[model samples]
Target: MCFEKCARCIGIALIPLAVLSVVADILLYFPNGETKYAEKDQLTTLVWFFEGIVGAGILMILPIVVFIGLKDNDCCGCCGNQDCGKSCAMLASVLVALIGMAGAGYCFIVSALGLSQGPYCLTELGWQYPFNSTNGRYLTNYTSWSECTEPKHVVTWNTTLFSILLVVSGVEIILCFVQLISGLVGGIVESCCHCQEIVRCNDIEVNVYEVQE
Candidate 1:
């Protein structure tokens, strides 16, 4: 029930989504290995990198679906006959979109949680673990969050990358859902219309034969 134009438009829109996720992942690379045990262990950067790849891969389905649809020039003419290629293509697209949605959704949730948790650290001030402050005098063999440099604890790069990952993947999830629905509904509608046309044609042929007899 959806026209080629509609599918094409959706496919075109998918390009940007893929690009955005890819870009976010590229940015995530900078902070991925920066997790130092002496500080907090922020896995946001690592998670973002992998999820961005998954999200980008999912977005690729739209373009492939569009390409297949375009290549099947006889789809409309052979409407009455089932075109396995078209059906398969649509099914494949739907499956890919579903996978993409799951991946993006996961990344979104993990990133959100990581953001809230503010990284994992046994103690906020590991750097100051060697010293303790008592009676206005600094003593050795003590560690506390109070002694750590506040600014050093903040992983600026990871925070920014994770924020970007969270936003881009969220957008991708919505797009994947839309793509799945459109492909499924459109393919079914087209198949039904083809069947109806074939029946109508058959009825016309039968009536003509009876009149001739």
Candidate 2:
């Protein structure tokens, strides 16, 4: 438990994460539809690859965990069980922070490194693709977005709120991670050294064990 008796602090730490998500939600105003494509360069592949990994790690994984925290762990003081409540509260807080940070990091990576793509172009199906480089050479050959001017999958934001959210979420997550490092590491080491100790773990207790008669 990184924070004892302060689930609120953990929750507060996620404020930046939530703020970034909210900011991303409102990022359609300015429009980043560049008409031109970027020129093919050494950095393009690396940028796109990093962007993909970051995207999956953040967007796909974070929201699900955070939602769990928001919905499940309300910190019921009425339980009157100190140990149970404390563990539950800490778990919820850590889950939320981890998920939020992952999401925020994805957004940041997308913003900074960006993804591989070209300008929009009409296809045989008649539906236009947002990033079709072969048709118009948007990203791999153009210098300015204007050369490939077209709507894209992700929106752009003028305000720096997203960056701010990323920073805030990163800090909170780092703190929470630090808190977990010692305890979780100790548990893992002990369990690895002696499997019987693992049997007692609340998180990994065997629901069913079979032995030949």
Candidate 3:
């Protein structure tokens, strides 16, 4: 039951994080709230990969649903036995949590790469990644951000949204890992308890038969 409570809490927490990731990824397409950059294909290539939209947002839905469902004891009505059903549900939750972790991990990696490579924007020379070769040093060096002349503060916009995705994905990964552990332990414990119940029932039946004889 504690595991179920934890799963429910995690599920609720993931909802807002997923929504935030999707919003951040969408924002990357339009720098400075202008669609001109997107029309000119000046957005970062990493944004096109949809790590935040697909990986962190959509991919997390299934796991969230599963985790939320874990809170309801009556929902696990498999094989005409509540204990067996609960065991099955907990094991299934472990698998769902793994899927969630994979999605969040993908988003985290892509966000990091996006931040390191910097955003694609138009400069005096033309559109390109101005800080691509900076090896992420530009993050701390405010002077380098001026390299991207167009899209007005694109460097700042990209950094803000990408940073948000990075942090949100990291938290998601941690929550999923915690849920995975909880589900695995809960499953094992429920299975052991279910087995003991069967043994006890069988012993009672045998003793009754012997007394009747």
Q: Which candidate is the best by TM-score?
A: 3
lDDT tens readout by residue for model 3, 18-132: 9999999999998878988788787888989899999999999999999998867533467688888888898899999999999999999999999999988888789889899
Whichever of 1 and 2 has more TM-score, that candidate is 1
| Residues forming the 10-long window of minimal summed lDDT in candidate 2 | 35-44
RMSD of each: 8.6, 12.7, 1.4
Give the per-residue lDDT digits (tens) of candidate 1, residues 76-148.
4444545544555555567766776777787687655545434332245443222222321222212332333
**TM-scores, each model vs. reference:** 0.64, 0.37, 0.95
Arrange candidates by lDDT, highest first: which order?
A: 3, 1, 2
The regions of model 2 sitting more than 4 angstroms off are 5-10, 29-79, 97-114, 118-142, 150-213
State the lDDT of candidate 2 residue by residue for 1-213, as single tens digits: 323323334444444555454444333222353323223221223233332234323443443343335333436732764444434544454555455456545655554333233223323443343443344343344344433223332212222333443454455446446434432443344334445444466334443332322
Poorly placed runs, candidate 1 (over 4 Å): 1-3, 31-49, 56-88, 119-124, 127-155
Per-candidate clashes come to 1, 22, 0
* lDDT (0 to 1) per candidate: 0.55, 0.39, 0.92
Model 2, residue 90: displacement in angstroms?
A: 2.2
Tell me the TM-score of model 3.
0.95
lDDT of 2 at 188: 47
